[model samples]
Target: MTRTPETPLPSPKECRRLREAQSLSQADVAAALGVTRATVRSWEKGRTTPRGTKRDAYARLLTGAEEVTPHQENPAPALVGAATGPVQASPDRAEPAPEPPSETSSASELAPRPAPELDPDPARGPEPELGSGLSPEAEPLSPSLTPDQAFDALYAFCAPALVRQTYLLTGRRELARESVERAFQLAWHRWPEVAMDRDPAGWVRATAHEFALSPWHRLRPRHRNPEPPPAAPADRALLDVLLQLPPVYRRTLLLYDGVGLDLPETAAETEASTPAAANRLLHAREAVVTRLPELAEPKELHRRLAEVASAERLRAAKPTTVRWGGEQRARHWTRAAIAFTVVLIGATTLTLRTAPDHYEPPLAPGATVYGVPPRVAPGPLSAEELALRAKLKGETVSGPERLVPEAG
Candidate 1:
């Protein structure tokens, strides 16, 4: 007699656990492999083993292992012929029972066909859930505003602070100004989306900081050169020292100290946590103190504050405008006058082209006309009026009439 090999089966609990670990539903797994839920359940319950390619697929999907052949692990045994009945004696002849279907045969028999090639990484992994689980239909904080209105409000509230922040971050006056302007332009386009957020100003500040640190600006040559250094007064020296710090530390210190924002507000503006902002401020202060020990002393700091106030006042009191030269003003007016004249000429030309082909003089002040004349000025004549008039008058007049004989 010959014995047949029993097929190995998978545990149902293991199948369910693997599916759960990968965050996949039975339906999802079934759909991916083109198999029905019942088929998967039957395999898991050990009622029947997935044979051939299906057995290989099962191993691959569940264990993430390479496909294994059935013959390698379980070879077919030889079969024996039955003994003859009655008195006849016979030798036991052994033969292989139809080499139990090959591994390929089992795979081909699966209801849900296996893929030609299996993927090592499927989209069944766990994902981090970051935002609140509120439905997308939740109400926004404010009614939506048009892009223009949102931009106007944002600019009015944040432009001044943005300008100062940019200067502190970059140390280049022109670059700082340009960065603020560019940030506002971008904000104008994204205003509708941004206006719904809790902190639009924070959004703008982060955008401005990113613009200031863009690759183009980072790769630009610094202002220093080998030329002889320009002489600078003590106050200018102090300002220069303040500008030389790295952008992150400089911005963190200025927003807290100069702008007078609380730690939380500073953190929001810089897009950092309160603790991070505090650490940045502390490091910046320490760096400055180490560099300028005398100014860092408490007593000296107070004295310097008084000096700073006086200098600020002097700067504020200085005249804000300077007169341009007469020649410059003349040139400006000349350009304006030329532009105006060109516009006027264009308007007249367009009117002539589009107007009706008759001439009507404007009514003079205190003049009145009650009735139509025999003929109206030939229906709003245009720029070609003179030539038209000459042609018509020539046609109306008689040819070569003599007036000399009329006196007799």
Candidate 2:
């Protein structure tokens, strides 16, 4: 008996069942096809069909499944070539299926969906347009200050805290002053990006700590030489010992003992977790105690630290201004202006050299000989010699045409 052909098109129920068997949801299928879940649902419900390119995509998907699972109930038919025999349905089916509609010139049509709406929160503004709205005239609400201004404001706010921290880190009155200045310069450069961050003070403190331990600051002549060490007063001798410690131990000890920063605050400034900072501080305290027996005696170290703290407060309270004006600003602008002028001059020279030359002036007239007789005279010649001269020389000699010889 001749069997009826299996439908080329899958029914909505069959499509849904096939997808479910593969453990794929409508959203998953839609994502794979770069379409919306609604589109996949419509296709499964037979309200709409996947068409043209999408139809080809559907065929590919089915073929992929058949390749992977050859024994699956519904194997895909050969789409490109003619079938050798009639198509058969799975034997478990109770009812016979209808014949597939003949192929048509027009494929199933997919309708375009509306774009998704964005979140309504004001904080969720559109991404900034690059190189746009950055003009000078575009004023920010707060009358946008420069990096220098922002740094100055931050320095003022954090100065007291920073000075105390600086003294703790450097163990020197003069070194701490210099370190804080250097840190402020670095902060001024990054202020545009960092000023609004939640932990700007911590950033400054970290920067100052790094500056204190920098090669330029830490590698003093005393550190390099073992013999003929530099002399210091008793108080400075104590500070010098603190400064001589390894950077990690020094900072850990300073944060806890000198600055009185808690473990968490120290961790925040140093960019370490709290437990790590606490461990470091513990080790540092032990090391300092081991090296300085006086500091190991609790009351003596506390007394020295108190004196240092007092000195730090005095330094912070004094009016100090960083003069970015005068020679420094002049030097910066002078270098810039020199560079600009050099470029301008170079451009002008290039333009002049490449340009065509025109209208060259005539050579100047030779000088006039007003008083001088023409350098040699136009002298007279004898007539006796005229006849002999005429015969020898190629001249038509007239009767007394005196030969006026050319001057030598």
Candidate 3:
């Protein structure tokens, strides 16, 4: 019996493109395929191939073909889970038997389905245009505020807790506010670049922590009374407990508890390795407990710290202004540019007006000169040579016209 052809498996690049085109993340595809995310990544990277049941499933997924149900006669599930040592695979197998041949199935139903054609019919409608759009003035209004949308959204999400995290680090309300503001200012300046990072908030928090810990504030003369604003009655006891901890331990605890960063992020902000950060967080908790015997366990300390930090209050609060300051910067640059241009034009005009006129020969054909001479000069020639040159043009002839020089 003639075997049915399988759906053509996609190339590695095509596989990745199809997955992304379907709006599926690698993790999403991995979950669907019952494989590790690294396996999916390797497939996309051409480090390995999806084969056996995996290829069939991938094809079915991408092509929207009928999935091989659990009850199917020839189910080949979890091929990726096994035979995963290498990318090589056996030759393509025939498409599996159709739906176990239902009682109402016609003879034609068992035959392989043809691949779908991509191009639309000529008569259906005009071919879709590419790079086509209405004019800038005529185009429909775009979704509101495209500029820095991702960064703006991120800032909106993280600013409050970041400020709180800084406050916890510095123990000074105004300094915390200033540090957070300075960090956000840097973030705004590099939003396009930083927004693409996997964890932009980590970077911002790290920067804010640096700002809070900077020694410049110490070098400057300070008033005798430079303590932070008095905490609320509810928070005073908690703040008193936190102030006694060292800066590293305090910042590490605050980063994990107050800002909700993961172990990696906490380590990153504190400039420690993951194991080191974990150790620091443990020691910090132990230190906190040693200071305050009322808190029994480390988890209890974390819970109490979270409550005192008021993460929920900060998370739900209206964000302080997420200003990028691009407009103000643009305005300043515009004024400076205009002033520079005016100066340049004035200098040029003054030079043109006061400078002496230069005698310039006519330009060659199709040549145009602006505020400069057109270079032109005859070759050096004797008066006798000039008379002979005129003779060469038939303006005059001294004697016989020499076709070539007699000697040299």
Candidate 4:
């Protein structure tokens, strides 16, 4: 029998857009398509194309998602774990599979969960409509909340997950916690700016990631000695491979694969061009695959990343603690600056008081005389004295005659 002609699917970008338009994450699509999340990612990235039944299923999924609501606003994307079996098309699309527990979930769960769409605190009163760029999930803060309240909410929502992510980056629980806390502290200090940001989570994430991967961490006394590796051999191996990658490469990989950020978003966060970020990710993946051939597939790599991150009990300080610390730090620096200013003013005043009003010309250094008189006159004086002495000696006589002569 002649093979049935295949129906063409949309371009990779269009496929991603269609899925995103429905607010379905890669995992949700992957689960519904009986493929791994990495495979879905690759398909979107245009690295690999789905074949045969998989292609048909993905096309149907996209088509169904598109036809459902052409003009409706997309809800905040829901993160879920991958499930087996092909997605079935019904009168109504099937509901997403339930997310697994945090401990056993994939790396996507290690990423900060989106904030609830609706404000939970009724006491804060109703909130104004959010701007198009600023989604409630991306930025959880309601306009009614005070700056401190907004900061706390954001911190509470993002800090725990950020700590876990940073731990995966640095392989040190303390550093991870510190990084997240510091990032939030900074965010709190710059509350107005951060609150206004479209993606506050992204802002904090970039800061925490930067802090976690800082070269200065290598100089820290505590970090000089390596932290204990994961008890599981596989986890330890995965962490080792991750740490072996250069900081830039490691960061790019983690943001894309581990944290589940899109390539463009990863590039933006990393402050690299998209192509550069892609190259770094590619090289990083290649290096990881080289060390552990088993992780050639992206899904396996993501699972291992989740395991490594979760293997350690990484905890973040409370939002209150972070806020207090940030305020204290700000106060300390402000006081120090004031003290420095005072000291500078005092020194300037003292210098002015002690300084001479007018310039005084310095005395010129003495010069040696070129023509000095010789001592030849001393020889002539000596000759005259000798003649006078001879004359006095000739005048001497016998005792009585000498006495009469002396009397005369």
> Each prediction's Cα RMSD?
31.8, 30.7, 28.0, 16.7
Ranking by lDDT: 4, 3, 2, 1
Number of the candidate with higher lDDT, 1 or 3: 3
* 1-408: candidate 3 lDDT, tens digit per residue: 122444567788888888777777775665455444555665677544444355577777776564422112112111000111111111221112111112232222112211111222355542211101111122111236454554455555445555555666666766776777777677777765555443355567677788888877787555235675444654566677677777788777665544334344345447766456666666666666666776544334444554454422323222235453544555687899999999999999999999979886878988866798777997699999989878678743475655975776
TM-score for all models, in order of appearance: 0.35, 0.38, 0.43, 0.61
Alpha-carbon lDDT, every model: 0.45, 0.48, 0.51, 0.62
Q: How many residue pairs clash per model?
A: 14, 0, 0, 0
The model with the greater TM-score, 2 or 3, is 3
lDDT of 3: 0.51
Q: Write the number of the candidate with greater TM-score, choosing between 2 and 4.
A: 4
Best by lDDT: 4
**lDDT: worst 10-residue window of model 3:** 78-87
lDDT of 4 by residue, 1-408 (tens): 112345588999999998898888886775555334655776787754554445656787787733332212222221111111011112122222212223222222222222123332357653221111223344324468877777766665566556767777888888888888888889889977777653566678788888888888778788778878888898888889988888899888877666555454456567775456666777888899898999776655655665566446456688888999999999999999999999999999999999999997765679554488765654444777889877777774642233334454
- Residue-level lDDT tens digits of model 1 in 234-276: 5455455566766677666655544333344455556665456
Best by TM-score: 4
